[model samples]
Target: MSRSLSIIWLFGLISGFNIMITGNTLNYWLAKENIALQTIGLLSLITLPYSINFLFAPIFDSLRIKYLDKIFGHRLSWICLTSIALVFFVYILSFLNPFDNLLLFASISLIISFFSSMQDTILSAFRTEIVNKESLGFASGIYIFGYRFGMLIANSGAIYLSIYLTFNEIYKIFAILIFVYLILLIVGVKYFNSFNVIEEKTYSSHTSSSHLHLSLYHSNTSLCHSRTSLCHSRGGGNPVNNINFIKRYYNHLGKSLSSYILKIFLDSRLRGNDIGKSENDLSLLSFIVLILIFLILYRLPDNFINVMINPFLLHLNYDAFEIASVGKFWGVMGAIVGGLIGGFIMKKKNILDSILLFGIIHALAHILFIILKIYGKNSTLLFITIGAESITGGMTMTAYIAFISSLCQGKFRATQYSFFSSMMGISRSIFPIISGYIVVNFGWQNFFLFTTIITIPSLLVLLKIKNKLQQ
Candidate 1:
């Protein structure tokens, strides 16, 4: 790879890592702080602001960051600002104890989440600008790997550290780590300047709407000619004059509209060879139900596990350290490995097939939890169950990520992906709340069974989209 591409990838890694660290660590820490389980679900509300970025992406496309785009450039400046803000916010959070000041902690977390979301938007747009279409899948893999590693550090490493240190200390250490990431991001901003600038200018000019304006002007000319033709046909001129006018009108209208529409569609290219012959080919509306089913069902087992696992551990008389250790070592590591493997497989295999297979494996993995529930909290069983769940979950996640990436067109990649990812966040956020209720009312075993049943709809959706996915 070129030096600029390498820098872009590194920035992606840093951003991914930063995002995951908080996501994985916060839950465990929140529970340890004695917050209600229901409130933990509400913590996902912090990400709600990110949903607006999708709505405003077109504005980002049109607006420049003033001299910042000329100074540090567009993508880099936004990324740097957001990264610094995120680091500052996280550091501030290190000082507040959630127990004494729940509002303060919640406020800081929301701020961090907002900055993190903006960072993600800029970083994703930067990646789309720098990386070639062919490299997107591999780039995504690297990102997920880095992200999962961060989770490992936060979930597993932090838990291990907590055995010897206080939660406040761990927060400070990770805050320092976030600062280190900020430094790396600054370096990336400098390194990527030359190559990314060229691509950005090229893409920007090509996707500009000047051509569309010209096309509309030509269409207006055609409409004028058509009016003239009608006047001639009403005995104002010779028949030949009428025919010539009508011919010119129809020809100009056809050429202008066709060219303009074609340009609009072709502006956002897809992954494969065939470009924009039909917009419907790229539309996911037909599969909205499929996507909904996939989201709800694929995540059900994990959601149930998330809700009940901590309480179940508490009930089994396992301490926070043990649960954190197992979750970090087995769960985090397995997810990273599975994500890497899934990304690799997607590079060669059909995405739909991969999703189906992983979904099936994920559904089957729930059986391990049932076994664990029956056998009761042996460390070995806990590790084994977590490992199985994480691996399958990772696989499912990787496939889903790749599938969503494939669905996005070049122009709207960031916005479209953000929308889809936010949908995922919504499901993830809501599932836990429902799972909490289920664990309280239905109990753990029945919850797992319900999760298994939910997987059926996702499987059917996979079948529905199988052929299109292969294409």
Candidate 2:
């Protein structure tokens, strides 16, 4: 790997870790502060700005800062700026007590979400630019592992720290960590000397060619010199060449888009023929439904239990430290193991089979949570449940990620992946909010049952897509 690519990976780790901590730990803290359950639901709304990032993605794609691109390259400059912003925002959150000023905390959280979204967009684009297609999966895995580790520290370590210190103190420690990360980022920026600068002469030469082509195609005498001059001014001299290049580029782009659209329509027809050819073979659709049902059922138990974990802990007389410890250590560890295993499975088996296996494991994992809920006061049960749940959840997530990765076509990877990820986020955002309400109204046991029921549809969908999923 190039030095610049290595530096970017390092930054990815730091940023991922920080984000995981903030995302996972904040819920526990808020619950401790006596925030209303409804308000907790509203926390999901903070991600609203993230959807907006997709709209402005094109702007980032087109524009680059002239001097900054020279200094740190386009993507790195964005990363550096966003990282600094993130550090400052995280630090500021340490000072405000959410219990005292809920609005202020909410506002801060929104700002953090916005910048984080921007950071995510730029970082993803940068990763694609720096890393080759083959290495991308491994890179994503490493980044996720680092992120999960950060969550463990924030969730478990922060909670443990809170046992001895005040929340303010815990926040201060986290702030210091962010500052250290920022310093390291600055150092990386200085060390990685791989900035790509576009030459002015190249830009001019391309422009001149474009203008000359346009002048020849059109017979209007008045349009010739004026159009050429305008192109020269914008293109910085070689207007004719620039115009031709742009015309050819657009023509190619149009053809590519047309082909892509045709492919989308044709894929179904091809799949249909394949199905007919293999009539004796079990249809992919059936397998997909089976897997989808399994996925829905697997998550159902947690969906129910997750809603009540805070309340149950409080009822059982567990302290913040214990909650944090379980989440950080067990949760983080499970996630890493799960992700790694999922990646390995993808490498070994088809995506559909891997997902099916994940579904089976996921459903079994929920049984542990059921045991914990039934034996609420047993520390042993809690420990077992925590470990089991974390591992299962991690594995399930990893399988899903791998499945999504396999689905992407190389040309439209970013746009398609972004859309798929957003759907995942939508499910996450909506489910938690609904789960919270269900827990409040139906109680934890009933909520678990409800979760089980909801999962059936997801499983059915998965089963329907089984064959395509394998591809």
Per-candidate local distance difference test: 0.61, 0.56
What stretches of model 1 exceed 4 Å from their correct place?
1-6, 49-52, 56-71, 132-141, 191-287, 307-325, 339-354, 402-419, 461-471
For model 2 the local lDDT of residue 326 reads 66
Tens digit of lDDT per residue, candidate 1, span 320-408?
Answer: 66777786667777887788777676555666677788888888888877777787778888888888888888898877765655554
Report how far off residue 193 is in candidate 1 (Å): 6.2
Q: In angstroms, give how far residue 201 of model 2 lies from its true place.
A: 14
TM-score list, all predictions: 0.71, 0.72
